[model samples]
Target: MFSESMGRITGLVPSRFLTLLAHLVIVVTIFWTRDINVQASLPPDFTSEEYEEEDLNVLPASTEVILVIAVFVLKKKSF
Candidate 1:
């Protein structure tokens, strides 16, 4: 039932257009996140050492997350 509705919807739009739209969305998200200042999201009381340690912990995790998401997205849909 759900597949029937989705097929009808997709039938109206070319597959290439849908694929392009997905890529555009990913690019826009990356650019939008770039505009945000990470430090601005942190608490004011954070010391330099605390900030350094926080960065060390967060950077690797964030990087891994993005890479994982990109891989999943690309793998799910061949582009």
Candidate 2:
């Protein structure tokens, strides 16, 4: 069913050639519109001391509780 559409093309271009043409067009478009003068900047007064450490010790305990509950549910369903 999928091959039926392949026969309708008026051009004799192979699928590989068409794919290459698409890639060439994409590359040309990217190079044609790319800005070369952009500069990166950081905010004023930014420091590592301003960032607080995140607490992640409670996540494993909650995940273990959820997994234990899930195992009990699966065991109940299988029996």
Candidate 3:
């Protein structure tokens, strides 16, 4: 039956591998769409220097957010 075949396929692949694949897909999707996203979020007259400055400002905040989320996930998993 189809269900049986699907169950066998799922069992053959590790859950961690699936999770990594999903993460990679999402990262690639974001990477490809970022220019469109930035244009929508920024003013039409924005220069390259302004965009670079915005990117620099975001880097630290994004890092801090990732760290906080990582800590939260670790703590939750420890419980």
Report every candidate's CA lDDT.
0.57, 0.42, 0.59
Question: In candidate 1, what are the lDDT values of residues 26-73, reduced to their tens digit?
Answer: 655654564243455568786777666656554654565566567667
lDDT of 3 by residue, 1-79 (tens): 2247444445334665567556656655655565666666679899998787666654554465466456546764321
Best by lDDT: 3
Candidate 2 lDDT, 1-79, residue by residue in tens: 2346665444444674577566556544544433221111223453443222111323444455556555546654321
Best by TM-score: 3
**TM-score of each model, paired residue for residue:** 0.32, 0.30, 0.45
Angstrom error at residue 38, model 3: 1.5
Candidate 2 total steric clashes: 0
Ten contiguous residues minimizing lDDT sum, candidate 2: 34-43
